[model samples]
Each structure stands twice: as C-alpha cells, then as structure tokens.
Target: MTGPSKKTERETFAAYCCDEATIDLLKAAAPSRGWSENMVFSGGIAGAVRALGAMPCPEFLIVDLSDSEDPRADVQALAEVCEEGTVVLTIGALNDVGLYRDLLHAGVHDYLVKPLAVDVIKAAMHSAEEAMNAVEEVEEEGPASEGKTIFFIGVRGGMGTSTLAANTAWLSANGGESTALLDLDFHFSSSAIQFDLEPGRGLLDALDNPNRVDGLFLDRAVVKPSEKLSILCTEAAIGVVPRPAEGALEHLVDTMANTYRNVVVDMPRHMVPEQPEVLNTATDIVLITDLSLSSARDCIRLKAYLKTCAPAASVHVVLNKLGAVPAEVEEKDFANSIETEINARVPFDAKAMLLAVQQGTVIADHTKSGKVTAGMKAVNSLFTSGSENADGQKPSWVNKLLQRKAS
Candidate 1:
C-alpha cells in the first residue's frame, strides 16, 4: 500500500487583516507540505480586529498597513484583537528600524514589508510552526532538523528579481531550510540590501581559493540571517570585478548542493561566459518576467540563448506582476511569444512585496493564505521531483551499453 501524502498533517493559518490580492497570493503557496489555508478579507485594520476577535486566531495572522500611516497605532490596535497563541505578522509600507523594533516590543511575532511572495510568507509561517513543533517534540523526543536549498532568478530585469530572490531565500533559510541565497548578479545586484546584509568577504573569496572551498570557508563568507538561512549577497561597493572561473563556480555549487538541499542562487541576466555552468548545476532555475512586449521579447531571446548554451538544464518561467484585471497581453500569447511555458503568474501584489523587502521577511511568514503559497510551490515543485528517472522510463543508452559490456 502507498503511504499517506505529506500534506495531510500540515496545519492551517488565519489572516486577520489582509487585502484580497495578497490573500490570493498567500493561498497559492500553501500546498507544498499539504497546508490548507482559510482567509477572511476584512477591509481595514478595524475590520480585521473585529473579525479576528470573533473567531479563534489561527496558527498565523497577516495584517496589512496600507490603510494607515502610523504603524505603531495600527499595531497597538491590532494587539488588542489578537490572542496569546496567535503569531502576529504585520505587512506594510515602512522599513524604519525604529518601527520594526517597536513592533517586536509590541508582541508582533514578525514583520514583513509589502510586495511579498507566497513562499516567503509560507516560510515565515513554517518557522513558527516548526518552533512550536520542536517545543512539543523536545518534551517527547529530542532536537530535530533538516535542510534544503532554493534558487530564485529574474527572467528579465526590473521585474523585482533580486527582491523576490532575497525574500524567498530569507524565508526558507531563516524559516527552516538552513538556506543560503547566493547573489550571482555581478553588477547592479541588490540581494545584500534586501536583507540588510553586507557581503564583506564572500563568493569572491571562495572563487579565489576554489580548492580550499568547504563549509568552514562558506561559513566565513556568508552572512547568517537567522539560524535557518545564510546570505551570500553581492557587495554594495560597485565595480566590474572579475567573475569566477567556470571550475570555481562549479566547485562552489557542488559543495553547497552536497551540504544543504536549499541553496537559492539569484542569477545575473548578462549571459556571461560562465552562465551555463551555473544554470546547468542548479536544482532549479526560476526565470522572472512580466507580461509586457519588451519583457516577452527579452524572454524569447533568453530562451533562444539558453537553448544554445545550456540546453539540458531545467528552466521554469514565472509571469511576474500579473494584474488583477485581465491583462492586454494574455498569458497564452505571452507564453507563445517567449516560446516558453509559464510556470506561475504572481499577481501584482505591490503592497505585499514592498512590505516583505522592507521588513526583510518573506510573504509566507506573514500570511497563511494558500493561494499565494501555491504559486511559489508551483515554482518549487519543478525542483522537488528527485533526480531519479521516472518509473519504467527508458534506460540511458550509456547504461545499456555498460550492461552489454558486462554481459
């Protein structure tokens, strides 16, 4: 008999205050571990408080601050509405340190600045769930943990590629993946700033001494965001530095893949000579694009370019900034024009994304909605299928040849 699906034991989440669009985004990210989410869209802060007060607070709480200028007052008001066990996560516009510190003091479990992704949000939620489960397990058993590596990239620039990559990496690593997000964009890279990280000595160091590369070297190179994730971010000081040699890049990736299952690489779009090496080695590559003519054209160019360079690498295209209203460029037409399939179309969730960047958290941490989480999972699912061949598939000719030789 087959085993039960991983999803069956997953917990549920409740959103006290959330926008319809963000709620949808959160819901999309829910199914990876079989999480089912229920959302209540109360228009504003007061509405959320009333709705939440009426019902038992779910495992997580997501609040939107778009309607208010004073986050302190909003959070204070929200505090009155929440129960002790409900982990409060705020979503908003500001990124001030003072505001974040104040919210933490006010009992906010976490804070996510807006324009968030489903995976980031889910990662946050999972962090809390994991912590709680760990507490329960410690009483019955002992310390338990596992790790994974997740990769994020921009299919095209100005599509919020760095932001999404950083947030997702932060969530998974910080949330529970013990994740490391590598910023591969040589120029104009923003992964460092997104998570308030500064890359002092990093990938460059590892590249310089490829043979010396090891966990100790990486620990020295990467910035630990939370116990869950590390940031191998780009340096803020700008200059066209020498890129790593193909062999060095490969060695670094192989080390990370062997060390952690959840390594996220935010790739540069310039198609450098070594690009294919990075692409081919990754567990998955997320190509971020918007539904615009220029973006579509660029996507097509990229697809054509990749076919020439790394034809065997698995690639998934994500339609970023998909609008609530039917867009002028239909998803089908865009897919056809790009000559690539659309893996996931993230709604234009500006508030959630912005909040996430500012708060230095992923969307999944703040909202429990499965819709947004599902979108991220769709992207993640591309990589989840192990490297083994599917059942009854044809054996490689190389394998057959080896068998005949043995015979």
Candidate 2:
C-alpha cells in the first residue's frame, strides 16, 4: 500500500465504518464539535486502506475492524497506508483484552468496542483533540534539544527587572549558548534602549496572528546585537494595549525555547494575571526586589503566586540595589517576610550604571570587573544553572527553596 504523502495538507477528521449506524452516530455528534460529517463513509478497514492510499490521511481517523477476520494484521497493514502524525481509533465487535492491547501496540490512538455510546464517542473525540494539540506543541517546539525558558519579574515596578533580565540574557549568550531576550511589555520597552537597537513591529504582528509565528517570523521581529543573542522588544503607544491573541505567547515561547539554548523574559507584573501560562512554562523565575518593606511584602506575594502556577520552576528572590534606599528594611527581616533567603544580592552603583547608560551599553559589559558586576555574575550564573542544590543532586525545586530557607 502506498502511504499518504506528508507534503499534502490533511483534513481535520474522518471515519470509515462497516455499518450505517456508526456512520449516523458520527454524523450527529461531529458537527457539534465543528467537524464536517460529510467525511464519514461506510466500508470499514478496507475502505480506509483504499481511500487513504489515494488521498492524504486526516489528523483524526477512525475505522471499523468489526468485519475483519484478523484485526491485528489489518491494523499493521493500515499503518503502511497512513502518514506519520495520524491519530487513529479502531472500533470492533470483540472486547478481548489481548485484542485491545494489540491494537494499541500497533499504533492505534484508541479502541472502541461496538456498539458505541454517544458519550463514549464524544469523550474519544476530545481525547483525540488533545492528542492532536500535543502533537502540534511538539512540532512547534522544534527538535529534542530542549531549551530553558526563564522569566524575570519585579516584585514592584522600577525594581530593575528589565536590567537584570537583559544582562542575564547577554551574559548567557557571552558564554556561547544561543540566547533570546523577550520583552513582553509592548509599551515602554527597556531592552531596546539598553541594547542600542530600535524596536521592530514583528512582536505586534506575531501577537496579533499566532499562526504566522515561526522561525522566520521571529527572525523578522528580533534584532541581534551580538552573534549568539537575539532580542525582541517594542514600544507601543502609551495608552493603547491590544487584546492578546489566544495561545500567541505560548506558541512564541515554545518555538523560541526549542530554537535557542535560553530564553530570558522581561515580564511586567501585570502579565502575571494576563498570561499566567507564560509563568507556568518558565524553567526559572527570578523575582527582583530591593530591601524596602514594600519589596519584602510583594516578594512574599509574588513567590506564593509562582508556587501555584510554576511549582516545577525554581523561584529566585534577588535583592537589587542593596543599600540604595535609606531606612530600608533589614536584610534578615526581608528574608523573614518572604520565608526564603536572598539567592543573590546586587549592590547599588549609580555612577557606574549611569556611565553605562551614557555609553548606551550594559553595566557588566562596560565595567568588566566590579562589585556590582560580581553580584550580577552570581545572579546570572544561577539563572543559567537551574534548580541544582549544592549537593549536586537535582531535587524538587520546592525542596531546594526550602533548603535555602533552612540554611
């Protein structure tokens, strides 16, 4: 049997069954789920094998094996005629345990023993939809070379979240890994100003139409200040914020996470509620704050939120601009409020930072060796290293956080 070509654009759903009863059931339930019932036909496994040989296989396929003398052999034969990525369901008369296991082993997505109930068919349809969605996620994420998606957010505004995020992305790329800096804020972007590059409309285009977000789409939106680093940032009009496209940020980050070794997101606090899924996908969460009482309280709030949404990712509480604010809350008290020790502390250096801004460059790049850069280097190292405890064992990220608290 000739297999369906991968190059052909496949239809959404189709079914071939031995009896009119099954076809009628699919026709009734299919339209409710936005599937076309016209694709439903009568003929069973032989029909599927015959029709798919000439046409492309659909994303979801169901075939009847009720009339087959040898179901296992027929399924194996059917696999030869379908292309990869086709999710198949089999309906048969027999309910033997061995037969169910054999059909699944032969790559059937699900098996239904007739007569099929309405709810059971609908449930199977939902499961197949989830399966198709999962396949799409994997395809969008690209190769098996998994990349880390790291998010940096401030406990309160003007706490240097973007500064730390941009520098971390730069430092990560300086180490020779492919890195992407994703500024999620459409208005008042800080990364472009820091990197000395103009913002592009590619992010707006991608957010507006997720279907157009691919490597080329990203290439158009991103600007590379260094060979290994790619940055996507924009400054939209102050009062205008467009509605977020469904699954746009998810698809974009998934594509970038697989495409690069690291993705550093400069996430505004508003996005925590707007796109919580972005936080959920992060491999690392960096919470930037100062030593003030407000910072301490919000650090507690943001850390608690991160646990609910991203338990798998490590939560890092960074004390930025240490000693900058007079009458600042004591370090021990701030740590007590959050119930977690500061993972790293970046001391304040106004003159050096202003000098770098004057030169339109990163402080770490301008002043290669300083106490400020030293603290930054420590934070950057932890950002790339992930949730590894000092014991060299990979433990639960929560446990690692608790260990930091206990220590």
Candidate 3:
C-alpha cells in the first residue's frame, strides 16, 4: 500500500541527438527494453557534454554525430568526461566501413548510419551491452579470482535481517573492499532508506529483462553513496507483481560477484523462482531469527530447506533481540529447539536502534559501543576469518601475483 503506482524518474539509458527520425525510432524502441521516452534528450553530443558537466553520466549514451565534421574528435572529447564503464553508441550520416572501424577502434561501442531502423538500433544496443559485459567479466575474473557473495535471510518478519546485512556491508566497504548491498525485496524494501539513499529501479529492470543484466546495466542501476559501497534496491508499487525473466537472479548474482570484492544480498522470506538458485550460489548464508517459539519453529524448517537446497553453503544462525528472550527459554534450549547452533546473539538496544533509524544510519554509525554493534561486528568477523586460509593468512603466491600485476 505504501508503494507508488508509477516508475521513478531515474535514467538508466539516455540518447542525445538532433534528428527527429532517430529520436522517433529510439522513443519507440525504448519501452520494449524497459526504458522510458523521457530518458531521451535532444542536444546531440554538445548537449551530453554540457549535461554531464553538472550530473553523473548514465550507463548508456547514444549520441548523434551525423552533424559533426570531426566525429572521432567529438567522441574523444566526450570520452574524457564520461565515467569509466559508460557504453557509448554513435549515430552518423555516413555508412563508410572505414569510419565504423575507426570508431570501434577508438572504443565507441558501436557506430550506426543515419536513418536508423528500430531493429537495427535495438541490435546495436544489445551488442553494446554484451560487449561491455564480456570485457568486465574478463577483467574481474582474470587469473586471480572471483568475488564473495554473502546472503542474508530472516526466519520471520521483524528479525533485523536487513539491519545486520546493511551494517556488515557498510563495515566491509569502509574496510577498503569494494562492496555492494543488493536488496531483492522489490515491492517492500527498506535497505535504501536505511542507508539514506533513494532507491533505484535496477533490480526491477534486471528482473523484467534478464538479458540486460550486464556491467553497463549495473552501472546505471547501482547508487554509490561512497567510493567503495554500491547499493541496488527498488521501492515499487504494491500492485506490481514481479515476474522475473528466467535465469534473471543467476545472471544478476554472477554480474555482482564479478564487479565487487564483497556482495551482500538482503533476501525476502517469500519464495520467488530465483530464490533457490540464489541460495545455491551463495558462498555464505546468515539466517536471523528472534528467541520466540514461532521463530524457532520457522528456523528449523528453513534450516532443513537449506540443507536440501544449498548444502554446500555455510549457514550461520544469528539470534537477534536476545534481551527479549522469555524466562521459559534459555539460549541452549532455544538452540536445541531450532536444531542449529546460535552463531551469534545480538542484544536488543531499542534506543540506539531507534536513533539510528531516525537518523537514516546504521547502528555502528550511531553508537560505537552498543551491544547490537558489537554483535554485528562479531558476525562480520566470522566472514573475514572464513575468507582467509586455515592458518589465517591469504596465499602468498596470490598476493605476490596481484602485486606484480599492479606494478
């Protein structure tokens, strides 16, 4: 009921051109790819240059170069201010093969002749997305390695799963690792609000069009509140039912793993088609629950489910709101009832948590010495420890190789 009926005005894709014909084609084709007509602007390369001077560049930029006498030079100038991973597509009046080859060599995603057909434009856009994704995949995976994915799911509602996930993710990012916090609850997600960020449509776009889940698409969707931390979340209308394209979750997870050193997913308890695959792909899973009997019963059922669905993943059970435990149940008894050991117990600090929520910050940021912060740190330490070798050191060879590559 709290969700908005219309999509937010965040630009995922943009086109800057003067030609009515090309703009018309793009306007017609945008919706098919989950883009809006408002995303298109009319100023050509000059307009893009002026706009980017004041704001962050979009993930994909389509510019008209048919009017320019020096197309390559104009592109070079545009590239100077563009973000590192932005995919650029150019539309020119000429159809010369030499010109196309020159543009491609200069890192233009693709060059199209004027009087563009809708299908041709769509095909070029797809090619650009795929090409950029392929390059990023190679860069992230290389000979060294892939990233780590940690998933957090609650046993029931109001268990503080999102809180823990957000704090841990912030800590990891602040510790110098490139981290991404992804909230998969499309309709009702508070991850963005928790971090004082405005939610974007990245997750919903990926779900609606799985094939578009690539490095360029992520660049458009992810909101970076800091240099190291990226957040992907959405607050959609309650009337909207998400029907993710097949393999959407898997593709999104794979892309995230390649892009960041640490990936945190705050998953909803309600099952979706991609839930099982996401759980299976996680390197670690944290299950948060309270001390109540209903929570224990749900935890037991979820643990059993994980055993069958994600046997290889390490599951950590966190008991939240520990101070609220009834007199009838002790920690040991609660653990026994749930059939899983309590990896961490977070004491309830109602005042501190409330202050944090009101300030739009995490517990660690609000109070450095609170029980909740301490418990979250302990849980995070487990992940840090698990990342190391048995002797608590990363392999020397891997470090040396990375050093040499950096040099």
Candidate 4:
C-alpha cells in the first residue's frame, strides 16, 4: 500500500484510506479544502499510525479504521500520540450504532461510514475545523485555577469520613468552585455509589501512570454527577492493594488540583501511615472522629503522625454522630485529649440521614435546615475561603516559623 513520504512541514489536513476510491476522493477534495494532495496516503490506520508517530499530528485527521482490529482501542492509541486539540475523524466499514457511541466516548470527533464521497468528507472536516478553532479560543482565555487539597480522614472506622468528604466537595462545587472528589480507597468506596453513579474504571491506571494522566484521561475516567463536581474512585476486586509508587499518589493529586478549584480526598485512615507521602502538599487535613475513648486515642496517634509527615498542613477536628449513642466521653474531653476543638459536630439525625442515603444525596439536600445539614454546611465552610485552617488557627505558619528559627 502507498504511504505518506517523510515530510518536514506540518499539514493542515491529512487522510489515510485503505482503498483506491477513498484515496481518490480525498485527493480530489484536498485542493478545495486547502490540504496538500500528497498528504493523502493509500494506507489505512496502520500507515496513519506510522506517519503521525514520526511527525506532528495535523490539525484535522481522517483515518480508515476499516481494517482496524479494535477500533476503540486504536483510537485511544491515536489519542496518546496526538497533541491536545488534534481533531480526528474515523472512517469505518461497519455502520453499528454501538461502535459509533463507543468511538465518540473514546473522544473521536466523529465517525463516518466509508463509501468515499467528497461532500461527506468536507462536511466532517468543516465541523472539525470549527471544533479546533473553539479549542484555540479557550486556550487563549487562560489556565484553570490550581486549587487546594483538603483531606478528610476519620480517626477510626464508621465515623462518616466519606460522607463528610463527599458533601464538602458537593458544597464546594455547587457553590461555584469546581471540585474533584478523589476517593483513594481502591475497593469498598461509596463516593460514587452514594451519588447514584457507577464507580468509574481506570483509577488504577491513573495511579500507576500519573505522568500520563491528563484532561482526556480524566474526562473518560471520572464520574461527573454535576457540571462542577467530579468523582474519581474505584472498587477493585479483592486482591493485594497496589500502593502508589513513592510519589505517584502525590503526582496524581497535584494534577487534579491543577484542574479543579478544590480537591477533597476521602482518605481511608489506614493510609495515613501507609501512604503518608500523598499528604505532602495538603492545605488542610480535617480529622473526623466520634466521642469514644478509643477514637480519642486514635486521634492523638493520627495527630502525632500528621505533625511528622504533613507538618505544613493545618489540621482540624470534626466530631460526627454526636448523641447517636450514650456519651462514651464528653465532647470537650475528647477535644482536650487531641489538643484541638471540634470544628464541626454533626449530630445523629437518623431520619434525615436515612432519607439522604435512600435517595442517594447529601443530608443538606434532603433536610436543608436540619441539625445534621447545618453541621455539614459548617464542615464545608472550613475551606470555603482560606489560606489558614479553620477557626482562625494557622499552625502552618507556626511550622514555617519554627523551621526558620531552627535553621
């Protein structure tokens, strides 16, 4: 099959076809479309891959997937080699609606059934040119806000850490700050389920390949419950949990924080000592606990650990499910033990919480003025607008000062 010659100059349009008819149609349309006739090649997806891999991808590209073994996977491979705004259209032999939708979801500009018509090719190219122009306009606007990371860690299990984290992200996003809820629990995460969404796949790949994670990967991997809120979580099968390689988790968080205005991490407390490196750049670390003697001890242990690993992070305490059961310990006593005051206390509102859980929503949405809802709002306000931690406590500054004096 004929293929593209090694050309040093970048082309505005390029086409790779498997048949003589398709090649002739593209060549005929090239002059009118301001494309070089030599850019049209008689090789299919394979030749497109070889040529594009060597040269910069054209502004508009058409590849014949008529011979592609797995078109969706092939398109994804093309995405890896292509720059951010390279508009791609796939011409295939099959006219299946399922494949069409799958290709769109995989980020192809459009899919065209190949019979080789100039009008059809030109129309698709026009739309693609518009799409590329739109991307350029957006890039001209400015970069997105590089946001802050807020980690919600429960001192012990059954402390509503996930709920608090999800609600905090929801409030932040709904209040017009685009937010990302990153649930680090590989298996048994409820962040997506609680929002009535299926947990997105590919979080494992993202963690393992942080350097490769980008907007395209996030668009496919994260579940967006609303325009502003996105959730990245996974329910991996029961197996040996993959610990993020050294700085992998941190890199992923940094990437996400660069995209959204706030990143609320639903951190499993077990990961505190296990993956402490991920806490490196956290702006705030809110510790959730109950009024129990054991939880109080765990809070102390966690506080000590945070001081070592994330000393720059300002820490806050949250007492949830107050009065759910008899007083194991007084709230004041629990706070005193941890050497911090309770930032937010969400009392046990069984009716409201049950309604929210059953309806797959936050308690604030179900019972707007209920005590529990108010408590959740209070938790959201912790990082609503601040550089320091909640309640005017700026321990991060203290840590910086102490470091300076030590030097």
Best by the lDDT measure: 2
Candidate 4 TM-score to native: 0.61
Q: 1-407 in candidate 4: lDDT tens per residue?
A: 55555567656788888888888888887777677888888678877888788887777888999988887667666665665556777898997655764554344666778675787677666666765664555456444332468999998889889988988888888776679999998999999987889997768888776534544556678998899899999998888677665456765776565456689999998888889877875979999988889988998988999999999888999888888878798877877888888888888888887898899887766677878888889988877654533322212212332333466
In order, what is each prediction's RMSD in angstroms? 23.1, 13.2, 15.0, 12.7
Cα lDDT of model 1 by residue, 23-87, tens digit:
67766765553665445354556556666555555555567776777877666666655544345
**What is residue 362's positional error in candidate 1, in angstroms?**
2.9
lDDT values of the candidates? 0.59, 0.77, 0.73, 0.76
Candidate 2 local lDDT, 111-227, one digit each (tens): 778888887788778767766775566466544223467899998987888988888888888876679999998998889789788988888887887644545557668989888
Per-candidate TM equals 0.54, 0.62, 0.61, 0.61
**Poorest stretch of ten by lDDT in candidate 3:** 1-10
Shift in Å, residue 101, candidate 2: 29
Candidate number that wins on lDDT, 3 or 4: 4
Over 4 Å off, model 4 = 1-146, 388-407
Q: What is the lDDT of residue 205 in candidate 2?
A: 84
Task: Give me the runs in candidate 2 sitting further than 4 Å from their true place.
Answer: 2-146, 386-407
Per-residue error (Å), model 2, residue 240: 1.6
Sort every candidate by TM-score, greatest first. Answer: 2, 4, 3, 1
Q: Return the TM-score for candidate 2, rounded to 2 decimals.
A: 0.62
